[model samples]
Target: MKTEKFQTILVSASILGLAIMFGCAAFQDAIVPCYISPDALDYADANATTFLPWTTLFDARRIDRFMDFRHLWIQAEDNLQYNFLKGLNAFHIRGSEELKTILFSPTGPIGLAFPALAGGALGTYLFSKPKDKRKIAELEKENKK
Candidate 1:
């Protein structure tokens, strides 16, 4: 019984992990339009107009801009492609005026961990549920009586 339970857990984890990984990959591939908040644009207008490329691999918290860590491919209003490795140099995209819409493409592992972690937790909960055969037997006995 213990071994069966363990096997169930292991299988569940593997299946869930693979499903989450693939599902997230597919979800990322789906093109979704995003709009920049007006406040953010106002801030950008006040500051420098030029901004970093928002890619899937980009971690806003990371201080290092030199690192090639972008996962998504960003196409700015200028119809230019920007990746993590190549910083927007001559092409300037303003947040207020020139800024319109981006052809957001997920080229790398962006927002992948969330689904994987969530799926694993769900799988553990589902597979670890005890199969109460005794309860069923008791129910059957009560029905007969």
Candidate 2:
């Protein structure tokens, strides 16, 4: 009875772990479009115009490299900011102050949940015992015999 219970618990935990992994993967995919849109470039361009004069301090080659580097840096920063705003917009769209609190607040559970849930799911999947271990062992023993 105890062994049966243990098997049930293990199966349930494994299923739950897989579900969490899939949910995390889906969440990541959903946010990717928000990070990669051309609108992010427009946002960066508008913000970077303020700092354009700083590039003039360098020679042409150096100025070119600096602008290239600066543009990439600004675009990356803008994408991050836009993704955050997109998440906030999603929360507002859902009419969920709960998600806003979870995502926007410094003490939000999302900070802990994302890493912990992902880690737990990965650990469970990688460490779980194979279902056919005994069969393989028996085959090996027969081969040896």
Best model number under lDDT: 2
What lDDT tens digits, residue by residue, belong to model 1 across residues 69-121?
22122224234543532455434534423333332223223345666778999
User: Of the candidates shown, which would achieve the greatest TM-score relative to the real structure?
Assistant: 2
TM-score of each: 0.22, 0.27
Error in Å for residue 73 of model 2: 0.9
lDDT (10s digit) by residue, model 2, range 12-87: 9999999999988765533332222234334433322223333222223333455577789989999999999999
Q: Which stretches of candidate 2 lie over 4 Å from their true place?
A: 1-58, 96-145
Instruction: Name every residue pair that clashes in candidate 1.
Output: 56-71, 56-72, 57-70, 57-71, 71-108
Q: lDDT of all the models against the reference?
A: 0.49, 0.64
RMSD of each: 43.8, 43.5
**Cα TM-score of candidate 1:** 0.22
